[model samples]
Target: MVHVYTGDTMIETTEEHPFWVEEKGWVLAGELNEGDVLRLKSGENVKVTKLERVDLKEPVKVYNFEVQDWHTYYVSDINVLVHNKAARYNTPTPVNPKRVDTNYLKKNGIDPHSLKYDTLGDGADISKYNIYVDKNGELWILKNGSKEFIPTYESIGR
Candidate 1:
């Protein structure tokens, strides 16, 4: 998922990557038009607009190792496998919460060890982002001015 920081808020979009033979099953980030539909790394199809505006300028932040080896260790085969597992680890299967959510595990009961928080770094400003966990057990980093990106469990407690 790629997000554009448009002064006030962020705009999100789902853009498909051109096929690459190196690694399979990754989504490349790029500009997202208004009505584009693409398959997520989770194998589920999502259409843009659950949150708000879609940005057409920001580059798609591709998380696949096959596309770009931004992370040095991720270039390895073993690391790729580990990353693949991490990507799906503890990820929610159902998209969102419906009536009578059985997964209400209580924020107070959530052990600090179980729930991890990472600072966006010193120079990075995420003030416009509203952080929230959905009823489906997915952690969302939403741009207050826009919409939510597909939540991934990869960065949690790592």
Candidate 2:
């Protein structure tokens, strides 16, 4: 039996929540009321003998990663950037901008070296396969044969 603390209130349960177990790397008691037995990882069974309420000085915090400024391209719209005349007609899966490397851009008919950077200035290089948002908030790309701004869903839907 192990003592599982849920906030300031202690309860006994058979197993701690999987999230708490993975995060703390310890067998914490989770969601027990009265008279519960918990089995430990070592196969030893423990019973909840007592429960007590204690005040916590601070609230617990959980952290998770969030991506910012990420761009996604749809299958139908890929033809605008892909250079291969044959593949241009085929529907491709949605792709992240970062996954498009310099070699892939060249195969798709884009001359990375000759493309002009948008507002990002000199630091922005076409070889990196970067997609940019223009002043009008539309997605734009520069390829070997085309010099037009591509309309994104946001612009087209409206």
Candidate 3:
């Protein structure tokens, strides 16, 4: 952990390490957050262990190297894989921002249908097409295998 002096007291923080998430790609150690899913070199998604900052002291040497045909590498002896900030096109990996509508669910018959929940507690997982109210009271429909506020849904039938 890195120690920083903030005027009078020292604060501990995790070092800014690089990570390559398959969904978003090249996220900072701090930006990874507590519950964000981290991507593995083996094409698997896993949760991060910790995101606190740690100092490596003064006169730190940084290395910059690349493995041909790949944008990720191992940083520690324990095989802590890290991803570069940019992909082949000088951009992060792209995620197809798809919006699967309720019609799709009905046509496919994705059951245990929990889309029309009666109460907040009865809502299905956020990854599904479950409606939820935010602290600000805005309604949202989260798509399957997703964790974002998928805006818009046909008004609930009476």
Query: Model 1 reaches what TM-score against the true structure?
Result: 0.28
Alpha carbon lDDT at 135, candidate 3: 38
lDDT of 2 by residue, 21-116 (tens): 211112223333434443332323334445544444775443222222222111121111111122122222223322234575466454334333
Candidate 2 vs. true structure, TM-score: 0.21
Record all residue pairs in model 1 with backbone atoms less than 3 Å apart, i.e. clashing: 9-145, 29-60, 30-60
TM-score of each: 0.28, 0.21, 0.38
- Model 3, span 40-80: residue lDDT tens: 33433455544446545675665556554334454432233
Select the stronger candidate by lDDT from 1 and 2.
1
Report the backbone clash tally of model 1: 3
Provide the overall lDDT of each model, using Cα atoms, as 2-decimal numbers. Answer: 0.32, 0.30, 0.40
- Using TM-score as the yardstick, the better of models 1 and 3 is 3
Mark the 10 consecutive residues where model 1 has the least summed lDDT: 72-81
Question: What's the lDDT for residue 118 in model 1?
Answer: 24
Per-candidate clashes, comma-separated? 3, 4, 11
Best by lDDT: 3
